[model samples]
Target: MELKSHSPFIKWTVRLLKKALYIITPILVVSILVTVSYLKQTSEVISKSQNEAIWFVLQLTKEYSEFIYQLQSYQLGTSDYNDMLIQYEILWSRFNTIVNNSLVEHLHQFEGSITEIDHHFTYIKAMEEQLLQLPRTKNESSLLLLFKNDYDDLQIYLNHKFRLSSDDLGNKINAVSTLEIIFRYLLISTILTGMIIAYLLLRESRYHHRLAMFDSLTGIRNRLWLNKKLDKLAKNNQAFNFYLIDLDGFKKINDTQGHHTGDIFLRHVASRLRQLEQPHCFSARMGGDEFAVIELIQLNTSGATPSLLPGKLVSLLNSSTMISGKSLTISASIGISQFPTFAKSIPEVLKQADFAMYEVKQQGKNGAAYFKPYSVSTMKNNPLSSVS
Candidate 1:
């Protein structure tokens, strides 16, 4: 009964947790998916940026190499001043194109790679007048050598910058990958936690269900369970014997020896009643000092009469018990009712059994009686019989 009283709170708590899980689980999943997608996009963008940086630097190096080749051809008399000047102009144009491009602005973040390129371009531009006079000036070979040295230095610096950019991009990719892994783990953990909570809730729900169906103190089926079973049997038109047993002298036990002793005595009585259980035989505690039993008539193929079972019940319950180191004795007044015989419905059968039990109590208790329809009206007029 204590557990039964707390059932409302337990049910409310379980419902609340279920609703929270239902709402939170989807939000967490969507959040994890969004985060992973953003990280993937970020990785792809960094990779593309690194590739563009590398390609840009390589293109500058190739243009400078072509310009050198043209200068060498002019010095060897294979190309004229016009050809060399055109190649030089093409190289300058290429440099200006890269400098004005948006990609170069993004490359500026790569440890000053663009700044280095700008410095090299400024130096070459300052020497432009002398270079255009190549194959005509007497200092052509010296100028060519100086230009080659500057180009070589710029190539080396750009190569180093590319390496730094590659390393930085790789670290960024790895960091993003690590973040994706972490979020995946968090998602898995959240799902597992939710599953565990759901399992525990199901288990707790079943536990409370058992608490509702059974007597808490005596560890037997309770009145609610008996009513359900009886209803099921009656609906199917299954014939069964119903026994309602009331413990005599129970209130005296509680008054003189305390409820603790009364409770102990009830437990012993329930244990004895449980011994009567068999195939198609059910026993339960209906409440304080009250118990019920059901036995299907069809299962009794041996043709055992209903009278024999009540006699056995009276004998078992009349036995003495040892509680708190003292010998205690108690008896029961049992009422017998049969389905489709004394009553056809659960309420009618129970009412008839209760009437018979009251008659037993009026006759001095410690006995059993079958329900008589005519006796019910007379018993109802009298005040309820008290526990001995």
Candidate 2:
């Protein structure tokens, strides 16, 4: 015999798995998000600091280049260049600002720049003191020739410093690249972890939701879930088919066969009900052997149920057979209640179905019944081709 599968356990496992994922997903997401944010801020800081350093170095190089170009006309032998002294003092002041500023953090590192800059100015300062005694308008081309030599000497030293500073900048840029790579990898790892945690968190959420709404024993919607759905349906003012199926003589199975056998019977019955072809049927456990199915779509209300399909709901219970040996027979006394036909309220509808189920047992066993007023229910108790 092909053994029947246990549905409640399978459904519960699926729900728990989903819930677990929910719990873990968010933590991963937030962590990755935080990492990406930190990396962006760090990259900005490093870039800004490096820019300030490069700007200072370039400023000194520009000033030195200009100073060297100006010296091309100077002669040092016979003339004192009075104008050159004023220009020299101004350039020195500017270069001092570059060296002394707090923005340039490491100063000793650029010693070549400092010494060469001062050497040229020291000689110019001497020239200026002497210029105070010479003619102002004369060309020092002959006299300036010596000044040119000292200036040339300055240029060679400045050039070497420029190369060193450039190398330093290149190395710093390399540092930026390395830092960027590290940040990128960190960000990637953070994102991956975040995704994993976020997934777990989401699963946890769903699992809790399932636990809240489902019966652990029967794999059917619990009372809480049914109430919620009923409220929604009522608010929408929609019509649906409702059924109450009570397994006849289930206590006999429990008492004679043991509780485990009863559980197996319940699982067997629940599993069979789940395989019904009706798309709109949803089953719920109203505690114990009482189970309910709600046909959310057009119901099998062939007898003029408003906005619902026409068909008797009798086969719903008859269609499922309990697992008995090669073929154990499971029978249900199905009571069907409809919207408007029974009562408009959810409670009233369910009560009518419950009442109708016992009504069949009163008449006879092995039959389905529709709840009708005691005065008018002539419909046979034996299961008929869906209530036409």
Which of the numbered candidates is closest to the native, going by highest TM-score? 1
C-alpha lDDT of all candidate models, in order: 0.79, 0.60
- Give the C-alpha miss distance for residue 123 in model 2, angstroms: 9.1
Which runs in model 1 stand beyond 4 Å of their true positions?
A: 1-41, 51-90, 93-105, 108-130, 135-165, 236-239, 271-281, 296-312, 340-342, 359-364, 367-388
Worst 10 residues of 2 by lDDT: 305-314
* Global Cα lDDT for candidate 2: 0.60
What's the lDDT for residue 38 in model 2? 64
lDDT of 2 at 70: 51
lDDT of 1 by residue, 80-183 (tens): 78888888888887788777777465576576666777788888898898985654675668878988999999988877767744666667778787878878
Q: All predictions: root-mean-square deviation over Cα?
A: 7.1, 6.9
Worst 10 residues of 1 by lDDT: 377-386
